[model samples]
Target: MEYVSVPTDIPDEQTPLLEVYDQIGPKSTFTQTTVNSLNLLMGMGLLSLPFAFYKLGWVLGLSLLVFFCMLACYTAYLIGKCMEFETGVGKLSSFYDIAYMAYGAPGKYFMVVLFSLELLAAAVAMLILFADSLISLVPVLTPFKPQIMIGSILLLTPLTWQKSMSKISWVSFVGVLSLIVLTVAILWDGITSPVGPGSIFDPQQTNMWPEDINQIGLGIGLLFVGLDGDQILNLGHAVFPSLYLDMIEKKRFGKSVSITYTIVAMFYSLIGACGYLMFGNEIQPEVSQNLPLVPSFNVLLNQSALSFIAINPLTKYALIVHPVNSTIEGLFNIYSDTLTILSRTFLSFLVLLIAIIFPSFYKVMGFIGAALSFMTVVIMPTACYIRLSWDSVSWWSRFAHSCIIVFGFGFMTFGTYGVMTV
Candidate 1:
């Protein structure tokens, strides 16, 4: 979608550090770009919650939040580098081309491989999850399970198959809202429930190490690694236009990226901490799958008329939220069993489908590990942007940052290899 040119009344100092492109290409119908990217990423980050709880318990979950913070800081820095080098056109190859513009052919090729591979893996993984959800919903449809999986590839192809980032942004927004409602309900039950224990940190417990650090390490690796692919790439896709706005322009790209990172990281950390605390070590495999088992909604959705309302939290929340923004907190107390069955059915289908395709849990871990590690930890910041920004920073500071990024890449590579071998 073509971006409308910013009004020219702004001061000379207000223009972006980088030259602003009047149009961000063909305009899209998607309105909620920021919201979509935020929720999808939070979903991926929270996907690790159950495993984190199982392996390390709540304490380690909190510790992992610290790691997420570090990762977010790094992400923001890379994004600023991306923005600083942005050439106004927000195409899929924007970052790769920007790196090329600043550095050369080597830099461009590296980014393309890194980003494209990572995004492909991410899109496939999400589609896998989507198919898995469907199969669990209708067992008799089992014969067509493979068809359903392939069907999703076809279904998503149009939605995301089109090159329009704006439309993708909107779809992402709907997906994100569905996720947010589920998250809110889960957290509400968590906090107000009888078992509520407010503090996330307890200083008295000293033995921070778990009995099996390998599983713990692997779980930790998966938590951050799954976050790459679609969500971050989408961020690169949508955020560039907004970053060119006056407020963001004067602050420099770093502050905007920093704010975005901190907000998103804190959100995931809170939800992960809350979910683990509420569910204890028995955290669900993925948040969406566990929605069916959520007790409050289960009881409320028992009736027939309200049954259809529970198909998936995505639809449920949107229908209610669309007409009246205030309806969410108003009617959350009402539950319908049909809604329960529907959500659970969806959850069951997804789990079974994923199990079939990725028969071994290790495959999920391995694929996610390699793809995310390459994109987030190794390729984008370290290899591509770093090459472009090599002279962008002072020599000593640049060298130190490069060393740290390299260390992160090495650890991620080691973890990916470990997942494959194990």
Candidate 2:
């Protein structure tokens, strides 16, 4: 509950810009932090929920969604506790900082690898999704062959080169607005569209449950991926740590996070439940593809969805590329603006190339969600909590943490296999 002030003695050049911001920038109110957290968690993940729900059946689907939401909230709280554990020495500015404190250099190295891989995969997935969405929005681009990837890279390269999170925060706001519009559009369509015979809400629908274990496993993986918003784990632009550091009343940080997650969970539930109920088994991986395109209102809804899909990724491109940029800069000790621009440009180009090579959007999301998200969101936090509070906490807490670790590994293994095979 105690608010820590930034040490003024550190040299400006030695301090990270983010650290500097924490020191001098105006602190955000609880409301602002809540909004930022909401923006961070909401994204393209919502679009895939209906397909995930369809695979699992309504009962199991909603149950897992709520389960994961609570799990994510708990792990996030564990992260805060871990940060508190290290607060006396200095501020834990990022997840890597907490990792380093928990298990020394090896822990730091492990987090770096997991985060770097996850961000790279996410960026590749975003690029592929953007290209696919653009093609869906404008059928004429189909003839151009790879025009989407090329155009996206060219347009986004300069934007990614911008080095300041403050500079990019506006784009993040725009991305948030896009997500809000997209969410409303999807919900509106779900409400207005006539339910078919196979609707999940209709008793006449058959095969309500998953046909096999494989389908259930895939559904679980997709659901995890759909809920993961930890792309904010990138140290260069992490949301939770920033929110914690920026809170006007540090004691209320937990309350703010709880409110934000609750709102996000509600949004996910509505989108998943309503979308699945509307389309039943007919829903596409990307719900936008399943939206009606003929009626004038429907056409507007479709465009809004497509526009969000296009802009969200582009706005997020920089945040995704930031860790890579920071890594290269730190490794080579290169701090010049020219080098920063060149590095980001090269990273953007590489992401574009990879996206072109492998254009499976939802599949990639499934892989990352199942393989990496569990580790970052569940395993790591729970392990750290156990390590930091082994003697201080109750024995039951340790057992719960152990179970979570086992569940995380099991889910990752089975989920990855399901995604690969299916």
Candidate 3:
């Protein structure tokens, strides 16, 4: 496997998560895990909150965001719990390891496929966001959208070649700062806009619920996508195992999940509500673009915010593709760095091709969150926990897990079908 092997001479203070797996003691503390979890939760997922609210309206949108946040936290807790399960080899060390222990090799392989699909969907979403943002920033380059996305493939392909967490660890900070800048800029613009405070409690163009009752499924799906950490099996799921293992008190990871996800839910609510209020029915899928959509009196201000938002996806692109590259390498046994880089380059072009084919930011992300991520985050963790701890789990616990799985399926099915038809 092409693990992000750290250099022996690297500074202890700058050591990345993957470096200390076998270290004497846990290198990460509870506070550190919570912060890392928050960083992981707050990525590109925020970009689509307004678009989701526009589809489902305020009532369902906010409600679903809260609901999914709790669900994600719970499923994430299950992941940490599954980590304690003995696999004959030792405790689980990774998310897929949970599958391998619970359901054996078949389960492990299924996880690999699902995890890959989740990454593929996420990579495509990033490209769409990248392409869409580029178009918004420079419309004259509009006709060159395809070429721009292709160019992104070339530019970002090299970042994927760096096979160490220390190299990409700094990206978490960039992602957090950029997202904060974009969110603050939007909020500031919205409050100062002529729209007034009324947009807060009640917006003119936004809805409390879907305009048509039949479209509820689509709205729910978009909400699911919005929770995709995205920038995770949308970032939360992808990084959970690493953070969990690195924790000083592993059992307490659930509390970290709760705190991190709630904060993220608040962030999503703030941005989603603010964006929908400002744009109302006219909102675009990427919320940052919506900031300048208004007869923005602040061209320089809005453009700077967009400039900040633009850097985030690129910073996250390689990290997002890292797992996908690693997965393909493991399957094909491509151990050499040369073959690894070649395979990653091929994967980048493949991602670009997929992005071109399914270009709607809203549709693609919604499908991924509902269909692919629903499996990785909601379904798999719950199932693995039940299987791994079936004998000890209470009947009520089983009932709750079953209920979550069943309830989520309704929306997952509806969301996937809705995006597919579009």
lDDT of prediction 3: 0.76
Which is the winner by lDDT between candidate 1 and candidate 2? 2
- Rank order (by lDDT, best first): 3, 2, 1
- lDDT of each candidate versus the true structure: 0.46, 0.73, 0.76
Clashes of each: 21, 0, 4
Reference-based TM-score, model 3: 0.87
lDDT of 2 by residue, 1-422 (tens): 23457666765554554455556556888888788777667766677888888778877888888888888777777777776664444557667787777788999889877877888888888787787777778867766537777888898788777667677766666656666787777666555545452233342242356756677767877788755674533321234766776666667777877887788778889888767776666777877666643252367767977877777788788788787777767877878998888877888888878777767777777787788888888888788778878889898988988999898899888888888887
Per TM-score, the best of the predicted structures is 3
| Higher-TM-score candidate of 1 and 2 | 2
TM-score of each: 0.64, 0.84, 0.87
Candidate 2 deviates by what RMSD? 4.3
Choose 1 or 3, whichever is better by lDDT.
3
Best-matching candidate per lDDT: 3
Clashing pairs in 3: 229-235, 230-234, 230-235, 232-235
